[model samples]
Target: MGEHWIDVLPVFSDYWINGEVFTCQVDPTAQAQVSPWWQVPQRLIDQLLKTDPGPVIAQALQQLQETRADLYGRFSPALLEMKIRHLLVQSHGQREGLMARIVTTLESE
Candidate 1:
């Protein structure tokens, strides 16, 4: 059998630059146990990716990149991605998830 990005569904790695968290792109072709693969929790997978949140997330990300490149460039892709994912899960309510956690962590750094 061969491993793919889908096989690693949501694995990631985080780093910091000027206090913002950034997710490093993990090589999905590599073994799961290799570096840069942070096994995301089932809970987050449910909140962010389950039930095909693709359309909503894709729209949000695209719009942001197009309309707000300056601000977008200020933040890390991982942080921006997390913020959009959080919006999808929370949906006009109190948002809580990796984005919140990372934001809190970043503020402290």
Candidate 2:
């Protein structure tokens, strides 16, 4: 069977201080239609974050590297490298936010 493909639609949502929310229009130049395999690194990183203490950057980077190696043929090398770096940075930001919340909760107790 041929590879399964999915369209990547970027959605931008905005929430105002008054509780109003709206979805922004999609940018035509940023649209991409790719296979689900391209999302493996993101999915893996998300799963790792579900653990009790969360995952280390190395673990997420390793997972991304492995996924890129396995699916090298599906995407450009440069694109895959860029995706890996992007995911690592994104994961770091998420971990920092979680840690801040935990610290705040603990301090209040």
Candidate 3:
């Protein structure tokens, strides 16, 4: 299947099964780009220093890109893609499941 981005989901992946194609579901929290994707720098510190957090966010993103590039250099595209897919799935699962676990524990207690 060719690569394509789903407008509703904001996910860029294609899935093929038994000659049918479908878009994968994305996490609801990640439905918006500004949610977990970007973090506000230390609020009190930034406010006290009167520094913008935008540059800090940009630097963090740059560092992540560099790390990803290094990893890609050391691995095949297929392997890297698989690793990224696995990580994304696990991250989303953890984010959703953690809340459920907390709620269940509180109810039990």
Best by TM-score: 1
Candidates sorted by TM-score, descending order? 1, 3, 2
Q: Give per-residue CA lDDT, model 1, range 5-77, as digits (tens).
A: 4344445676554697756677779655655455677686666656677655565556666865655576787
- Clashing residue pairs in candidate 2 (N, C-alpha, C atoms within 3 angstroms): none
Off by over 4 Å in 2: 1-70, 93-109
- The TM-score values for the models, in the order shown, are 0.36, 0.24, 0.24
lDDT ranking from best to worst? 1, 2, 3
Clashes of each: 0, 0, 0
Candidate 2 residues 65-106, lDDT tens each? 564444444555456445544544555546545333433333
Residue 56 of model 2 has an lDDT of 50
lDDT of 2 at 42: 71
Judged by TM-score relative to the true structure, which candidate is superior, 1 or 3? 1
Q: What is the overall TM-score of model 3 with all chains considered together?
A: 0.24
User: Worst ten-residue run, lDDT, model 1?
Assistant: 93-102
- Cα deviation of 5 in candidate 3 (Å)? 21
